[model samples]
Target: MTKHKCFLGLAILATLVATPAQAEEVSRKAADLMAQNSNSTDSVDQNSNNTQPPNTPLSPSLPSEPLYGGSDTASKLPASNYWYVSGSVGSASPGNDVQGSSIFNNKLNFALDSTSSWNIAGGYQRGNYRSELEISYSSFDVNNASIDTQSFPFSGNVSTTSILGNTYWDIPTGSKFRPYLGVGIGAGILSGKIKYQGQEADLGTGSSFAYQGKVGLEYELARKGNAFVEFKYLGIGKYQNDAGRDVTPPNSYGVNVGYRLGF
Candidate 1:
């Protein structure tokens, strides 16, 4: 019976010790589970904060290049060329002597103001300098009697045509306007018919050298084109007869208006 009682005591002691050990093991496991859950939640929160939108990317920014200043971007702008047509009235003047009847000899003088005549022309130009080739035609009659002869009208018709080549240097003075000066050299053909004693006589007919000097202002009408007003002193030098006789020629001062098509 004592042996049995000893065995019972030992068995009861062992049961109590085992129960405490099992409870401690369960507590340690619970703590480890809580730690693992805490680590998982922190990872989820960090991932949500660190993410980027679908459209955004990681890269460095770049700078833009300027258009003005020494950059060639401004130089790439278009170039311009110009063309035009103009018209005006002008007068002829006495240049040299003619030989014929006493009243008809070397007698031509400047056309009367009433003898003003009309002309037409066309031209072309490029950049700051321009060149033009033109053809002009005019016909007018003048009656000038020597102060000595208060009696009769020195009546006749003088017709002239010219082909000229002109060049200009255009100076820019404003954003919308420019001033220009030019010179022209040309050849002129003059034909004179005199009505004397009810008979028509051809006095002088030939080609002569001519020239002009001009000044003008041009106002831009389009971004690449302009309108201009010009004043010129034109000299159509002396005409000579087929027989080498010199006759009156044309010299006139006039103003003209025209357009230029810029390049």
Candidate 2:
């Protein structure tokens, strides 16, 4: 009985110690598994924060691309074929010193007033220089003249047409305001009639030599348009009338406002 009791006590102690050890081992394993799960979850969150979001708007990312959608890549103006056109309207005033001679060999002087004028031009440009073809028109009435007591104080309507070839030099200062100098030469067609003291004379349509010079400033109004103001001096040589007399037109000075279109 004593030996059996002793064996029982030893068995019970062994069972108690083994139970606690197994419990400790199981707790340790559980803790390790929890740490691994926590680390895995933290790593997943960190990777998600570092990742970029989807569907962000990056531009159609080249300079040549259209802003919206197109396969065509030309988004800027073409380099070649820099052609342009212009239209202008302004005032034309005559000079005081133009004179002509009648069939009687008498000196006939004229005084003219300011008149309305307009022009249209088209051209191509290269390297700051441009060549243009222009057409212009103006009309005026002469109020006073001096040929004699009977032929003085003339009354008349004069219409002029000009077809000109022009060249321009644009001073490139890389600014929105462009300053330029221009010169033009062509033929003028003059036609009108004059009356002095109940005597009327017809000035037939005749071609005259013409020339002009200009100074202008342009403002960039848009990508393809410009507004400008210009000062011009235009001269026309004498033309002969059907009566074998001369019709001398006065030199003209003009101030103009204009718009230009480029293509």
Instruction: Please estimate how well model 1 matches the true structure, expressed as its whole-model Cα lDDT.
Output: 0.63
* Clash tally, candidates in order: 5, 0
Estimate the TM-score for candidate 2.
0.66
**Candidate 1 Cα misplacement greater than 4 A, ranges:** 1-79, 82-111, 114-122, 147-151, 223-225, 261-263
lDDT of each: 0.63, 0.77
Tens-place lDDT digits, model 2, residues 187-213: 998887778889887767788899999
Q: How big is the positional error of residue 72 in model 2, measured in Å on the Cα after superposition?
A: 15
Cα lDDT tens digits for candidate 1, 35-54: 67668889999989977877
